[model samples]
Target: METAQENRLNPFLYLTYLLEKLPQLPDPQDEKALNALLPWSPSLPLICRVFTPTK
Candidate 1:
């Protein structure tokens, strides 16, 4: 992380790298709480297809 800061790495490129490196869990059985943090959106990909429409 220090190296990235020192080298002035591009923020977008760093974000892409971080996304690619993140674990892609198929199941949301243990992710209900985290899922609650993300608001449903038409643009974001349907990761676990667990969208709860607002009433």
Candidate 2:
């Protein structure tokens, strides 16, 4: 059985862990990868915005 403390995970720490484990975003020019991510044709700017990391 899990305790209440074990069930509670820090949001910030969880986000950090997820970000660390996330693979690098594929290049916008890579058609195969972009196709996998988007169903329809996506513009360069859209891809850039989606993949670009926020400060």
Candidate 3:
């Protein structure tokens, strides 16, 4: 079942979704720190389709 929290955030699920993608990031460990600072663009969905949105 989907969590109630996911329902609260629209467009994107939450930062957890963003955090999960950190490991796959191409940047070095040091540079990965800036990942969160990256802008959210249409390319976001390309990272992980799993957490995009059920509906």
Candidate 4:
């Protein structure tokens, strides 16, 4: 059975789909280096943070 959220168009789902089509990412430990190399591009956790609602 599909939940309400699943029925709706979710940004996370789209992001996941796009990510799945991309090449494999570096190790989590390399996040800092990745950030330095591509400040404009956000990591998975950072992407989640942007989508999350702040209290």
RMSD of each: 15.0, 15.4, 7.8, 9.4
lDDT of each: 0.42, 0.38, 0.46, 0.41
Instruction: Rank by TM-score, highest first.
Output: 3, 1, 2, 4
TM-score, prediction 1: 0.30
Candidate 1 local lDDT, 1-55, one digit each (tens): 4443443444445445446534454554546533432333233333423335689
lDDT of 4 by residue, 1-55 (tens): 1331342324565357445633454564566654532323334334322344579
TM-score of every model versus the real structure: 0.30, 0.30, 0.32, 0.25
Best by TM-score: 3
Model 3 per-residue lDDT tens digits across residues 5-55: 333333254455666777666774655455443443334443333445567
Better-scoring candidate (lDDT), 1 or 4 = 1
Clashes of 4: 0
Ranking by lDDT: 3, 1, 4, 2
State the lDDT at 50 in candidate 2: 25
RMSD of candidate 2 to true structure, Å: 15.4
Better of 2 and 3 by lDDT: 3
List runs of model 3 lying over 4 Å from the truth.
1-12, 28-39, 46-55
lDDT of candidate 2 over 1-55, digit per residue (tens): 1221243433344345435433555565666654443322232223222233579
Positional deviation of residue 37's Cα in model 4 after best superposition, in angstroms: 23
Candidate 2 lDDT score relative to the true structure: 0.38
